[model samples]
Target: MKRQGGFTLIELVVVIVILGILAVTAAPRFLNLQDDARNSALDGLKGAIAGASGITYGKAAIDGVESLENQTISAGNETINIDFGYPADLAALEAVVDGLEADWSNAASGAAILFGYDGYNQRCVSYTPATGANVPAVTEVIEGCGTNF
Candidate 1:
């Protein structure tokens, strides 16, 4: 009888079965990365919004435009709309933050920007500016917008 040098059929079948099992168990873990990335992006955007507001307010204060409404300031070539020394609208926020490619919708008080990921629109950040102050309230809408990720 001749000796075989390759893997036997039983051995190959067992190997394939183990690989299938591993894939079945691990696939879901990797699939959720899109949602995680979206969440991270939202956090970063929130921070950016806060930082931009502060910087713009600082510039407005320096230029003596804190009491001026609808004033525009040039922040690194981007024009930011100022209202009482704070960011006024989505356009102003986007101008200071830059590179935000999410879809925006006008809210009752301010604006909401929606970022889609993992086939859901669950990530939303809302900006609502106060009437008499330079502080804008930012809210992260994790529920009621779409499926929570």
Candidate 2:
């Protein structure tokens, strides 16, 4: 019955079991955060899209600039491109999207949708997790999630 200088095997096993249980419980919650973050990002992106579309439409209406497809605006040293495709054309607007802070977990999947011309550009940015929580896909769910875009 002498005291041991190191942890006993039973104590180590108990510690490992506790750690394992904690990890098992926590893993799912951690994974769920990505879903929550993606949803939040989607909401933010939706807002940005609506705002940008409103601004762009308003400008187009005011200036009588019909057919706003592939139009680029110069803002200082930067350029902003506007897309008026039947649906959303993300590529045409990617250049100006560099203004987005890559950490945006609120909507556009780490992208920004912009509206307006030159001094009028307003942005709505949504971000994705670096771990690929919001990677783009061609799934029905994804397409449905992007109806607002």
- Candidates in order have lDDT scores of 0.66, 0.42
Q: Write model 2 residue lDDT over 7-98, tens digit each, in one string.
A: 98999999999999999999998877755665565455555544444454454445553244545544356544543311124542333234
Q: TM-scores, in order shown?
A: 0.63, 0.37
Candidate 1 per-residue lDDT over residues 19-129, each given as its tens digit: 999999999999999778767766776677677777888898898887777788877767778888887876776677667545433333225444334355566555565
Each candidate's root-mean-square deviation in Å? 4.5, 12.8
lDDT of 1 at 51: 76
Runs with alpha carbons beyond 4 Å of true place in candidate 1: 1-6, 64-80, 99-119, 131-136, 139-149
Q: Name the top lDDT candidate.
A: 1
Clashes of each: 0, 7
Candidate 1's error at 144, in angstroms?
4.5
Candidate 2 vs. true structure, TM-score: 0.37
